[model samples]
Each structure stands twice: as structure tokens, then as C-alpha cells.
Target: MEKIVSFIANLINTQKQFIKDLKELKNHKDIMVKDDEKLIQQFIKKKAS
Candidate 1:
């Protein structure tokens, strides 16, 4: 019984960590997308001028 309890606790912790990592990754992707958009805008302005 003790072993089963410990195993379940470990699994829960792993899942929580996985969720946190996924959220961080998503935020990084969002920032990269915004940066890319700004670069594209600058390129367009430069081309127009």
C-alpha cells in the first residue's frame, strides 16, 4: 500500500511539472510570434520607402 501511494504521488508531480513546462513553452512561442510580426512590419516599411 505504501508503494502504491508513493507511485501515485510521483505520477501527480510529474504531470504537474509537464503542465508547467507546456505553459512556459507556449509563452515563448507567443513572444517569438510577436517579434516576427514586428520584423515583418519593419521589412514592409523599408521596402515601401
Candidate 2:
């Protein structure tokens, strides 16, 4: 019984960490997308000029 409880606790902690990492990855992706958009716009403007 004790081992089962410990195993379950560890699983929960691992899941929480995974979720946190996923959120950070999502935020990073969003930032990258924004940066890419800015770069594209700058390139277009430069080309036009």
C-alpha cells in the first residue's frame, strides 16, 4: 500500500512538471512566431524601399 501511494505521488509530480514545461514551450513558440512576423514585415518594407 505504501509503495502504491508513493508511485502515485511520483506520477502526479511528473505530470505537473510536464504541464509546466508544455506551457513554457507554448509561450516560447508564441514569441518565436511574433518575432518571425516582425522580421517578415521588416524584410518586406526594406524590399519596397
- Among these predictions, the greatest TM-score belongs to 1
Q: How many backbone clashes does candidate 2 have?
A: 0
lDDT tens digits, residues 1-49, model 2? 9999999999999889766654554465444544645655544454478
Q: Provide TM-scores for the models.
A: 0.57, 0.56
RMSD of 2: 13.6
In model 1, the Cα lDDT at residue 47 comes to: 44
Candidate 1 structure lDDT: 0.63
Off by over 4 Å in 1: 29-49
